[model samples]
Target: MRVLVTGAQGQVGYELLQRVPDGFAVFGYGSQDLDISNADQVRAVFKAVKPELVINAAAYTAVDKAESDAERAYAVNSDGVGLLAAAAENLGIPLLHISTDYVFSGDGDKPYTPEDVTHPTGVYGLSKLAGEKQLSEQCSRHLVLRTSWVFGAHGNNFVKTMLRLGSDRDTLSIVADQHGGPTSAGSIAETLWALASVFRRDGRLGWGVYHYSGAPACSWYDFAKEIFTQAADLGLLEKSPNVNAITTAEYPTPAKRPMWSVLDCEKLVDAHGLVPKNWVQELQTVLRQLGERQSV
Candidate 1:
């Protein structure tokens, strides 16, 4: 089976490129390789590649910048996805598209299920929601996998930011009000590749909206504390610095995040029988890959 992946340089896409699944031929494409929003370009690529499966990791992920660049965000996140869905539908193949937890309003006390009502507070989330709608309307065989707080060794992410700051400074301030899982791109890539393998073997899999994130829910402050704690334990940090927890009010940004974007994985569990993995373990691997020493 041949798979076409978009946003090849991104956190998730890079993982897919680095560790492709067994018994499959994969072609990874970045924005330069294929402009998803361009209908002609999308059609041409799909025709040439003739892939059995398409995984769309391409997205305009600048959460705050989306507030100012709404047009660009929608172009890539919404319209771009629509083009991919159309091409996939035309090819009569499955399309696995990535989404985000920001689609939810984030005010819920409990975890969000796949069937929960969506009310995005920011342009980024709203645009992603638009992309999800495009898939539902355009493609018959599709998987909209919504993930949260994604971090990886290959790209810029919260974990890398913390590592850089913590290594040089004695203190870091992070927001405590928001809560969600800090999922690793490695985990997402692993699961997607597994799904691709199964789908290739069976030629079909029950497809729809699914949520997969890390095991435990935590605030940015909690995530940072964990990063520093694990980094120190792994001898990756020069010093155990202070992690000052503050409310969202203390940290102002262009985008307003969901206070509780935690997603319930029960539906995904019932569908795929895959369980969430802990991020701390993944973090250790990422830090080590980044040249951090393992504690003796």
Candidate 2:
């Protein structure tokens, strides 16, 4: 089966490129190759590839910046997704779209299920929610995977940021009130591969929304401390930074983040018969990769 992957240079997309299983042809496109925001370009690419499946990883993911740039965020996140869905719908192909947990207002301690009401608090979340809605409305065969706190080897993510900051500063303060799992893009990509492989054989697997992330949930402060700990274990940190916990208000941003945005993976687990690894274990593997790269 032929599969098309967008945002090929991104964290998740990069991992997808690396982890595509045997017996499938994967074609990847970065922003320079195919800008999904352009309907004509999207149509052209779909026409040429005529892929059996399309995984859309392209997105405008600047959470704080989206507060001021709502239009661009919507164009890339919502409109781009709509374009891809339209193209796939026209071609009778399944579209697997990536979404976010930021769609929730983040007010409750309980993990948000697929049926939970979405009340995005910022432009980024609003745009992503719009994209999810568009995919659901436009395509009959679509899988909208809503994930959170994605980190991976090949892109700008919290793990990389914390690693850099841990080396640069002796003390760091991260918001403790916010809670969610630190998902690895590699894991998400692998799950997508599994889902896509199944969907290719049986189209029944490519409908409805699913939530996935690392097994356990944690706060941003906790995640940072874990990153430092892992880095120290890998001998990557020269000087360990004292990561302090602070309230969201203490580190105010233009965008309002959800205090509790953890997603319950029960539906995904049941649907795909899959399980996510512990977040700390995934973090350690990532740190090991980073250490290897630095040494190389």
Candidate 3:
């Protein structure tokens, strides 16, 4: 099957391009190649590619920046997604889009399900939620995978930031109050491919919004400790830095981060027979890749 993927240079998008299974033809476009927010660009690309499936990995992901740049964020996250959804709808194909855990208010103590009432706290979350709504409304066949704390070898993320800091400093401070799954971009790409494969075989999916993230949710502080431990073990760092646990109040940002971003992924497992991978194992793989890159 021929597939079109947007945001080809992004973490998950890069992984999707690399891990295309046998018997599938994939075309990937970065922002310079195809601007999904532009209706003409969207129409032209869809007309040219005529893909059997469309996976939207493009998003305005500057969480804190979104506060000052809501218009751009909505253009990419909200309007871009709507355009892709409309294109897919026109072609009568499936559009699989990625979303975030920030759509919630982050006040709850329990893990979030897809059915939970959404109350985004900031511009970023509000914009993403708008995108989700656009996809649902515009496309008949679509899947929205709401994930969190995505990191991978290919892009800027918390893991890479931690690794950079760990190597440079003797100590580092991380927020302990906020918690969520540290999902790997590779894992997310794999999940999207699995869903694509199922659609290829069955011609339909248990379509709708579903929560899929890494196993064993953790705080930023816990995530940093793991990163340091794993980096030291891999010889990526001379030594693990002293990770200082700090509360969210200690470190403020323009965008309010969700204090609790844990997602319950049982719905996805039940529907698709897929399970979230252990983030520690995923992190090890990522660090190994980074280690290889450093040597080169």
How many clashes does each candidate structure show, in the order listed? 0, 0, 0
Residue lDDT tens for model 1, 64-142 = 9999999999999999999999889988998999999999999899999999999999999999999999998999999
Model 1 residue 253 distance off true place after TM-score fit, in angstroms: 0.5
Sort all candidates by TM-score, best to worst.
3, 2, 1
Report the candidate with higher TM-score, 1 versus 2.
2
- What's the lDDT for residue 275 in model 1? 86
Q: Which candidate tops TM-score?
A: 3
Candidate 3, residues 15-44: lDDT per residue as tens digits?
A: 999999986899999999899999999999
Q: Output the better candidate (2/3) by lDDT.
A: 3
Q: Which stretches of candidate 2 lie over 4 Å from their true place?
A: none
RMSD per model, one decimal: 2.0, 0.9, 0.6
List per-prediction Cα lDDT, in the order shown.
Answer: 0.90, 0.90, 0.95
List, residue by residue over 100-135, the lDDT tens digit for candidate 2.
999999998899998999999999999999999889
| Top candidate, metric lDDT | 3
